[model samples]
Target: MKSRHVIFPSLMIIFGALSLYFISQFAEPRFQDASVDAKFFS
Candidate 1:
């Protein structure tokens, strides 16, 4: 039971890193993103 407490956080960090890696790999980068951010800020 005590071992699981350590294992859970480690697994969570690994999975979170993997998800971010794939998202950055295939995600689109566009110039229009500045337009969206401007709208959000203003």
Candidate 2:
């Protein structure tokens, strides 16, 4: 029962970190523009 206190927060922190890392990596495009040509040329 006591372990649950530590384990739950640990899992939450790990999950949050992984989620943030992945979001940062894949969420933002290198090219801010939406059009293909603009992005390709810019």
Candidate 3:
């Protein structure tokens, strides 16, 4: 039961990192009128 608590959050962090890396690969450049870059939001 104690291990379950640690495992879940660790898995969440790993998955979140993986997803961010995957999404960043497809990020586009900033728009002409936008102040921030597209990757910043991605």
Question: Tell me, what's the RMSD of every candidate?
Answer: 3.9, 6.7, 4.1
Model 2, 1-42: lDDT tens digits are 999999999999999999999967764564454567446655
Of 1 and 2, the candidate ahead on lDDT is: 2
Q: What's the lDDT for residue 38 in model 3?
A: 45
- lDDT, candidate 1, 1-42, per-residue tens: 999999999999999999999866654453255677446545
lDDT of each: 0.75, 0.78, 0.74
Off by over 4 Å in 3: 29-42
In model 1, the runs with Cα more than 4 Å from the true position are 29-42
Instruction: Look at candidate 1 and give me any clashing residue pairs.
Output: none
TM-score of each: 0.63, 0.67, 0.63
Higher TM-score: candidate 1 or 2?
A: 2
Ten residues in a row with the worst lDDT in model 3?
A: 26-35
Model 2 misplaced stretches (Cα beyond 4 Å): 34-42
Residue 41 displacement (Å), model 2:
25
Q: In candidate 2, residue 9 scores what lDDT? A: 100
Q: Highest lDDT: which candidate?
A: 2
